[model samples]
Target: MRFALSEDQRMLQDSLAKALVDVSPLDRVRRFAADPADTAADVWQALAEFGLPGIVVPEAYGGLGLSMLEAALASEALGAAVAPVAFLGSVLAPLALVRAGSEAQRAEWLPKLASGEVLAAAAIGEPIAGARDGAGLVAKAGKLTGRALFVPGGLAAGLIVAADAKGGLHLVRGDAPGLTRAVMPTIDDTRRLAELTFADTPAEPLTSNDALAALRDAGWVILAADTLGASQAMLDKAVAYAKERRQFGRVIGSFQAVKHLCAEMAAELEPARALVWYAAYAFDHAPEEASLVAAHAKAHLSEIGRFIARTSTEVHGGMGITDLLGLHFWFKRIGQNRQLLGGPEKVREIAARVQGLIGA
Candidate 1:
């Protein structure tokens, strides 16, 4: 069986990377991060023109009708650029609607989401419908009460797919009555998070019983892929810096210790790239294995991404921590990806439970 990406997938990755380089370079990301008010509107527009917002939406709904593998590829490119766009929600919201939404829901929202006319966010991180921060939503009589934390793209989303305490999915409009949103600050400013409070806010329930499982699997795969791209970028930056920086009249890259650090990072990360690909492929092809594989990918990449971030920074010496080279963008991106959804320990526990090695 072929385990490699098809030629078309490679082309897609290349094109997206090039577009991001032109539109969201490190300097542009820095400017966006410096100002909380800057929405990175032009960057998101470029992505919309490239069809990223609609990559997985059905072609009938004005999307490319691509698979999760393609969406994961897009995520990898976005991670490499560290672009300040609300992509996690853009992808997840459409996936949720596709999997569980009624005909009217899809007909009403998918087209607008695909065309970038409406922005959407997904607040499904709660595993058992409760957040680690003691925040969660309760659904009653077609309304939601309580709160959701760490909602990506919540501040600007026109629609939100929230999971309730019963593991049910519901859709909430951004302008719904009694709905309130507050931005949640994090170390990584490129991706904005928000806390959502719903006070008997009206909601529309999705019909599928299995949508939450599918959504979680896809989330893990995408987050793992994002970490993969960001890790590779940091490693590349470190290698480039090592080659140029001289110590004792010789390039630092020539030192045995530096060579080992670079080699170790490559050795560890290169194989993990295949892990992410397989997880994504499983999501689209082998539903039975998707959950376990995605959990492994997310957990493994979180650990590896952190290692790469630290080692890559170490390679840059003092400049790594400094803002001059802007290495912290990739660093912080990796760090944030590590904790999003579920961290390594939490994901590993899920994997173990899935395998029946532990009581669920």
Candidate 2:
């Protein structure tokens, strides 16, 4: 089977790239970053107008009813622009609801999510879990009592898809009586994170046995896609800067060192891009391969994105790290993506287990 994006997918990708560039350029990102609230209301509304918030939701729920590959493409555009919006959480929550929610739950929540009327944060990676793999959440008496750290867009979510220590998933209203949220300090201001504390919070349990694994894998794929997009942006920026910047009476692009740097970034990026797309495809078409491929995609892109981020900054020299150029936005975004949902070491270990290379 061909592993390339279809003509329609390509058009969607192009349109999204252009739309994001127009609405979320560097200056807009800078403004959002500097805003104490860190909200991107205008950009978020623009994306909603494009039906991006529900890219992965089923069509019956007023969504586009697209697949993971389409979601990956949109994510790549958002990452390239480094738009300050909670696209990731919005995408993943619906996936969980579709997989696990009761018919009633899906009917109630999916439409709101599709219309961008509400935001959903994922409460995975509780400290008690000791890993980012969405464990250590405890549910008792239909109530949740645990702390979930690094909740994506938690502070703004109207709903939260939280995990239980036993691998069960639950939908908890963000305004549950015992729920409290606080913004966590992060290296990447563009991706807002919040810490959530629960004390006997009421939660609606989901029944789908496959929900946890599928949701986790979906999250991994989106994260990988985001990094893949950011890496490409880094490569483009580096090449553009090299062609324009002068050193020793010659364009830096003419220098062997600069050429090699840009070439290496491109080399690292190309394979990762293909791998990310394949991971998205596998999630939709090959369930057996989804987890392993997601792990591989996330692990590979995390490191490669770091390299691109650093090399791109080097190509710009002193200006790369400065706010004037806002290259740090991409740099820090890659940095944060590397560690989310576990770093390379952690993801690789999981992949090894999936390959039966280690004991369960």
Candidate 3:
């Protein structure tokens, strides 16, 4: 069967792209990175004005009530612009709650999250490349004590959904009595990551234990989609550079070697897009296939994204490394995206489990 985006989905994607053009240009991204605080308040406000924070939230909670597929489309646009926002952290925390929280919990958190009044971040992957399951924190007597590292947007988040050693999900406020966060510097300045330490921090348990796998798969799918967008942007930049930069009295685009590089990059990235799109669609429609497809998409796109980032930089020669061209933003973003959630090796192992190729 042929898969295609519906008209409304296409329109939503286009609208978000148009909005980012003015709000999160490369110069704006550079400015945010240069600031010590690493915030994009104006750019975030622009996205909040567009109701993106509520895109995947239920309608009862003041959201558009869209599906994961639509959210993936928005993610693509965010990746294309390399916009500095907490979209992943904000969306994933609420999603975990929505999937497993009690009715009271949903009533309290979903509306605020939908309205962008509060931002949520997930502290699932503790050791960067560890298992996506919440196996890092140990819970006792309604309090948690452990360290959760590499939490994206944790320092800026108002609420945090943390995973426990037993696969249980817990919600802890950012200002809780025994919680501390420190920003961790990463290669990608556009995204913020933090290491959180909990010293008997109080937390509320989410009731839905079955939702953990779903949430993990969703996170992988969104990251893959983001990488897909970044890959395309890098390819576009490289092509533009090849067309304009001249060597030996002719445009570099005239050279067969440059043409081959661009062509090979396109060939690798184009198929990866289908994998990401299909993975997102599967999450909404086919539950049995979602995990496997999400893993495949994340693994494949991450590798291709690295290749695109490297090849694109080479296309510009020394100019690519200069801050003036701003190619490093995409390059660094791809580098970080590769290891988030889990690297290709870890994800491929997960996929093998789904296929019964290895013992669980």
Best by lDDT: 1
Residue 250 miss distance in model 1 (angstroms): 0.5
How does each model score on lDDT?
A: 0.91, 0.87, 0.87
lDDT value for candidate 3? 0.87
| Deviation (Å) of 29 in candidate 3 | 0.8
Clashing pairs in 3: none
Error of 2 at 50 (Å): 0.5
1 versus 2: better TM-score goes to: 1
TM-score of 1: 0.98
Candidate 3 global TM-score: 0.96
lDDT of 2 by residue, 1-360 (tens): 776789999999999999998889888888888886857888888998999988988999999999999999999988999988877788789998988899999999999999888888887655312444442568999999877887778888999998887778899997899998888889998878888888899999999877777877888888899998888988998999999999899999999989999999998899898999999999999999999999999999998999899999999999998888888898898888888777889888888888999997
Compared with the true structure, the alpha-carbon lDDT of candidate 1 equals: 0.91
- Give the clash total for candidate 1: 0
Candidate 1 stretches greater than 4 Å from native: 128-130
* Candidate 3 residue lDDT tens string, 1-360: 758888998999999999999999988898889996757878877888899988888998788888888888999999999999868875687688778888888888888888777888988875334743343688898999988877887887888999886778899997899999888888998888888889999999888867667778888888998999999999999999999999999999899999999999999998888899899999989998999999999999899999999999999999999999999999999888888889899889888978999997
Give the TM-score of each candidate.
Answer: 0.98, 0.97, 0.96
Worst 10 residues of 1 by lDDT: 125-134
Model 3 sits at a Cα RMSD from the real structure of 1.9
- In the range 1-360, model 1's lDDT, one tens digit per residue, is 887899999999999999999999999999999999998989988899999989999999999999999999999999999999878888888988988998999999999999888999988877532387778889999999988888888999999999997789999998999899998999897889999999999999998888988888888888889989999999999899999999999999999999999999999999999999999999989999999999999999999999999999999999999999998988888898888888888888888888999996
